[model samples]
Target: MPGWDDNSLGYHSDNGKFFCHLNMTGIAFESNNLIKKGAALYPCVGFSMLQKSGIGGSAEINFGHRMLKYESITNFDI
Candidate 1:
């Protein structure tokens, strides 16, 4: 699944016990507008992340048979 996130220069300040992400947060799809292209519809979830420093941050991801393709495809996370 393709993912996206905003900057993190000061996104985290240890300000609160927990942090909330912005709305319009992110989106994911099993298949695009590729029906005509023979793309099969599968389930998938996008991932989210926030880093305050290099290798420092929190990550949110989506997974499961109900959400992602169970077979016929290999998953790659970045």
Candidate 2:
């Protein structure tokens, strides 16, 4: 298993129209599936962010039990 930590920052519009969230993940160690013992490992970091806005009518819509609609969804990774 790999140990990890996350730091997050977020903001939302006062009018409930727009929102964004950012996260930074830090890995404590390296892991490999094929090599179990005496394997080389290194620590690393990652980042992600999401931004969404209301369009047409609202940011989201729901129908019955399973249907859903998102105005916009954007994701980033590094």
Candidate 3:
């Protein structure tokens, strides 16, 4: 889990929940999931493989360098 430690946070797609430091925030928000703060932050992604042998998952990430299928948010400063 990405938010299992201090200074880390994660939003889950399965339950639409946010987690931080081994606890769920219990508040859900609908947005592009952006954070703007003065502190230094890094981008992260995580995956889990519970099955021993099966078809795994995949991800395609676009770090604001290409076109997206939907409208983009314009005020991100990080």
> After best superposition, candidate 2 residue 10: deviation in angstroms?
24
Pairs that collide, model 2: none
On residues 26-76, what C-alpha lDDT tens digit does candidate 1 reach at each position?
Answer: 432232233232323353344344465444334455555356534433245
lDDT of 2 by residue, 1-78 (tens): 122333322233336775322223422222234233332334333333334643222333333386445443445632
Clashing pairs in model 3, backbone N/Cα/C closer than 3 A: none
Worst 10 residues of 1 by lDDT: 1-10
Model 1 reaches what TM-score against the true structure? 0.22
Q: Give lDDT tens digits, candidate 3, residues 29-77.
A: 3222454333434567777776868656788888669998887344463
Q: Residue 33, candidate 3: how far off, in angstroms? A: 15
Residue ranges of candidate 1 with Cα displaced over 4 Å: 1-35, 53-78
How much lDDT does each candidate structure score? 0.36, 0.34, 0.56
Q: For candidate 2, give the lDDT.
A: 0.34
